[model samples]
Target: MDVATVKKKVIVVMGATGAGKSRLALSLASHFPAVEIINADSMQVYRGLDVLTNKITPAESQGVPNHLLGNIDPSVEFTCKDFRDLAIPIIDDVLSRNRLPIIVGGTNYYIQALVSPYLADDVVEDMAEDSRISRLTDVDLNDINSASAFKLLNEIDPIAANRIHPNDQRKIQHYLSLYSTSGILPSTLFLGDTSRKWGRADNFRYNCCFIWVDAALPLLDRYVNDRVDSMIAAGLLNEVFDIYKPKSDYTRGLKQAIGVREFDEFFRAYFAADSSWVNSLTNDQVSSDDANMFTKPKLSGILNSHDSNTLRALLIEAIDKFKANTRKLLRRQRRRLNRLKSDFGWKMQYIDATKAFQDESDNSWSVWVVEPCVKIVRSFLLEQPGFLSSTGAPYNVLHLTSKDLCTQYVCEACGNRVLRGAHEWEQHRRGRVHKKRASRLNKCQRTFSVDQQAAKSADGELNSTFCNSP
Candidate 1:
């Protein structure tokens, strides 16, 4: 019997942040016989920073069971593997009860790991335990300079280095760590196997129906900015303040949340400039106050009470940066989704919520986004034709990608900008910016050649006269 036929069903709701993924998932619960939502969001797993992480409230959950959400310790590092290990049993239990498991979040990797059984990183980790392989126990990530680390990676495993940016210290360190610990080149782990690169569609653990909630960039930009302001009005600053500690590592755990580090400079300046305010907001004093007292209005009143023009300015700048970073994250998520659909050939039903977002009405949402998604999920559950597991890989540029993944291109026209893979290099070469820069450089070189020729001719004339006179 085909595994696809026996495989259980799982619905995945994915989107950029602020795309209303959680809302859609909750709405989905009412239509099903029994539904349990497992969170795939990396940050939302942490216990604290509820408002900052944009966790769904108990009231907002609409009585549907939500697992792995706001339940983990904030200080501990929770990885995709950890999420996968925890979520699989929960999903199995949900399936045993014949309930639908709906995985929802902005975190794509966690979803991928749960659905696909084969992943490169997981395989490499398994291989690391071989007794023959030597381990480097003394490696300190902080001491490894970005340039030197990348250079070392290029020397040892140029294929891996080619795929990663020189400035991507994390990936560089990861590849180096794998090499040192496993005694194997990171690129060779795949052995040019395209299926294991990220995770192949053939090794799917369950029958998954992917629904991507997307919006127009212009509208999404506006919505996210408004959402950030609303978050502030809903006490985003209070959440940040609660998590704030001097010199806390912003790169780890819940501190990695977007709103957390953006306020670091503002908070530092605010406390430094006002000793009295610092005294007023000590842990004991803050604890004594009503939890709701730190609302946006009260915080604003407090800031205004002090001589805090500079502090207010810093706060405004931080808020602006937070909004800007969110927009950048939106673009990156959009790009990654496109890549998953195109390069990896994941079958995803794209539901454009642009009109729904524009109208901002429940009626519009039900008609535009919810109805179509419900229909798709209904078909998937029934195992209708064309709604079965997506095992067919789309014929794409992926045939060339195996080698391209190990190739690097440096653009001389763009002041030696490095682009990974042939596809990116081709895209860069065809871009208007690169074309204009190349044209300008070519014209300058031609002009310089003419000037040099003219100067030589003048020198010849002067030399001829001097020779005749002598």
Candidate 2:
């Protein structure tokens, strides 16, 4: 087989949470010479919360030279653009050394940023130094009302406006910012260039091999639940407690991890249960106005054993929510991967790890998932025929296109819910809730019409009787 390929080679191991993507990447690393792993998991990039984020241990990495793993500040908001900028250089350096860079993570957007050259935010950032952008005051940029900003975007670029949710102020601001700085319609950026759109598989930066590690949903759900239990045993609660500042922004950074925010209620209740601990706090130790009155160390020493039934119930509920959210994350990851393959023409090699996960042994993983994946990667590197075959799109694919950016649907029956793309609108229209609401609305309209007709008829009869009497 001819081994000719694109300019550079990179491998991406993608999967839902708890699918053993990192393990597979490590296993594959051992099989090849000069291999380096790049972490693409969004939450794992931030320092601390090792247990909650499920970061790979140094022992687990086994000296594979993992880059971008747990080096970021927990408070810093790491964006997709940041990941792309950081990762591109690392990938190039790996390629320079003739070492294979295997990107292992569940963060698909990070992967997309690496593969595709165009990101809307990147373009906007590049235009930040422009005179037009610099002339605007901070207040002017920050003080714009979301509804008005969205309206402005609609007037300027309706296609871009349609793609964003009205409730999503961040995206509205981003688009408006982009247009304001560049003096170009936001829609124009994505109009002709298919590569500029989401999930650009047609124009990739490297000769990429995408390995999607997946399992059956039922099995995956079970695995995630078990994994959450394992996390709890591994001191997930302790890790969360360390960073449990009351009213900490959960929207950004390491705090956005699945396990962190779920524990908010439990922690709040636990802390409030022991008011004695709060009373003992000195003003210097904790601010009088600070909501986080009790430090973790102080709380640990004082109220560790005071596990009331209410606290236990709350803790249990939090644990249940964590597991449920992780399961939801798995579903979302799977859907995104499927969309990447079907809509963007990403030729991903799907390797089912269901049997391997079921057996739950090293030997089982070797036989069922690892060995097969290693062989596939070897074939991919050698440009062999077997690995080149495309696993056709899943039957349930929405068949979305680039024009989806311009597509918008507002469901009046569903409280005028704004849905982007044809597939989403179609799904919304077909949903049981929407159907029920529409039926009820139609019935009410019909009843109103009949009542109006009867009232008019009564008035007409009254007028005729008066005329006849006269």
Best by lDDT: 1
- Native-referenced Cα lDDT, model 2: 0.79
lDDT for each candidate structure: 0.80, 0.79
Q: Model 1, range 1-470, lDDT digits (tens) per residue?
A: 67656778889999998888999998889788599999999999999888878899999987899999998999876767788999999999999998999999887878887887766666776666673645556666547678988888898878788778897665787778778868777876666443444544555788778899999999999999998998987888888877778887765678878888999998888667656556656655654244334433445554445555777778888999999999988886886676676556678888999999999999999989999989999988876777644643444444524445446788887888888766667767998999999999999999999999999999999999999994
**Residue range 258-299, candidate 2, lDDT tens digits:** 899999998898778867655656435555435343444343
Please provide the root mean square deviation of candidate 1 (C-alpha atoms, Å). 4.1
Error of 1 at 135 (Å): 4.6
Model 1's lDDT to the true fold? 0.80
lDDT of 1 at 42: 91
Shift in Å, residue 318, candidate 2: 2.2
